[model samples]
Target: MNSKWLWPSIIAVLLIAIWLYLPPGIDPVAVPADSDSIARGEYLVKAGGCISCHEGSEGEGGLSGSAAVESPFGTFYASNITPDPETGIGNWSGEDFIAALRHGRRPDGSFYYPAFPYRAYKGLSEEEILDIAAYLQSQPAISHSVAPHELPAWVGRWQMLGWNLLADWKEPGREMNDDPEIARGEHLVRNLGHCSECHSPRDALGIIQYRDEFKGGEIPDGHVEAIDAEALNSWTEEDLALFFLIGMKQDGEFVGGKMEPVIEHNTSQLTDADREAMAAFFKRGLPASP
Candidate 1:
């Protein structure tokens, strides 16, 4: 082997290793009918916050895959994840669903780009993932089919597979602590909250900058959002809670941007206790001034 090629080869090997470990995109579950299963599935859906991405807004048919999500590269439509056999994941099996969520691949065996949030979802447990799939299946299937994302020629669709290899994640689910409050906050943030997905910055390869930890950063699409503990610490816990509830600050400032969808889909739906728990976790983790 020529010494000149060593660096490239090493890089290639590392990238392959990373890709091999990325979570598959969709979690397929056989439709479950047991009451207990449905109940568990419901909780898992709330925990995963699936409705935020799949549902459409006014004028945009609801859950029919017309919701356009704005990203730095371009606007990508949120596809239908419902159980519609014609257009959604309806025909998928539980193993397929698990593979997608834990690994980032579709049932057809294609890689799912990080834009789908499997990066954060990789932490979900198998049991929890099953529940989520069950819950999804239980929802009324929507029949709207959307077009594939149209990327600029410079960025080919297949190129994303290589990118997936570079940024795949395999961390275990959120850890629970003896402190109920702390544990609750951690669950809300790590699982349901998905704060890290947007707040943390991604490298050229699109993997989140874990080293920076929550120090605020740009998204893969170049949109800026503050996740820094210091900046978050500036707000009082109460401020964070109120902001989460209504997407506005205590001072009457409106919170907008990519976060708007999150607030609309998930945060606004959280119970007061969960919001307070999130605030508690943030206040403790974020220092007053970093």
Candidate 2:
């Protein structure tokens, strides 16, 4: 046996075996098709901040996917999430929708750019994901074709595989010892709200740095920095809740810039209890300033 040929053949066989065993996208499942399911989806959409990106700010376009989100890589135009058969997700199956949210893959199996924030969304339960999908399907079908991302040639769908390798893709679970309020906050902040996706700094590879988690970082496009999570310690729970509810500080300073839409579309829609839970969680984690 020739040593060089033997090693090359063995490596080729191993690579082939690995490819064959790779899991395919999850099979399609039948989601609930009822008004109650759609209503639940609507609530989850707001909680998840879907409109903040899909639809431009209040004065801009509607949820027709006309928004262009700026990022370190380039400008990524949000896709049409409306139920338009031609340009939106109207034709997508339940599994197609779930795959995009949980695995960041399109119906054709192409990867979505991390700009979609699907990493945090991956923590959602299948029921929740399907509910959101059902709600999207109920929306008026708007025909809109988003512009392609302005990325470098080397940046492609395949690159997401490497990114996923380093990401926390597991679903979030409950802690038996966690306080109820704190637990609710953890779910909102870490899973549904995905607050750290923006507030934490990312490395050159665009991965969030866990060591600096919740410590302030620059927003995409380098225009503004996200407030550090610890900074909330300086604010009273009432103030924090007010900020989430209305984007206003106790000092009468209004939240402007990118956060305004988030407040208007997402946080503001949360129930008072949810806001209180978030406040309690933050206060419990960070010490109040002396």
Q: Number of the top candidate by lDDT?
A: 2
lDDT of 1 by residue, 182-268 (tens): 678776786566777767666765577765546666644565666566767568889888987899976698877667777777777
lDDT of model 1, residue 165: 49
- lDDT by residue (1-290, candidate 2, tens digit) is 78879999999988975563354558769766799999999999999999888994344355777687777777788888888888888898888878888878888877789889888888788999999988989888877777888887877877677677766533233453258887777667777888878888888888888666677667654534444455664677788888899999867999898889899999999999999888777777533334
Runs in model 1 lying further than 4 Å from the true structure: 2-31, 57-62, 154-162, 168-180, 217-223, 286-289
Candidate 2's C-alpha lDDT?
0.79
- Candidate 1: worst 10 consecutive residues by lDDT? 165-174
List CA RMSD, all candidates: 4.7, 3.5
Scored against the true structure, residue 220 in model 1 reaches a CA lDDT of 45
Cα TM-score per model: 0.78, 0.87
Evaluate residue 215 in candidate 2 and report its C-alpha lDDT on the 0 to 100 scale. 73
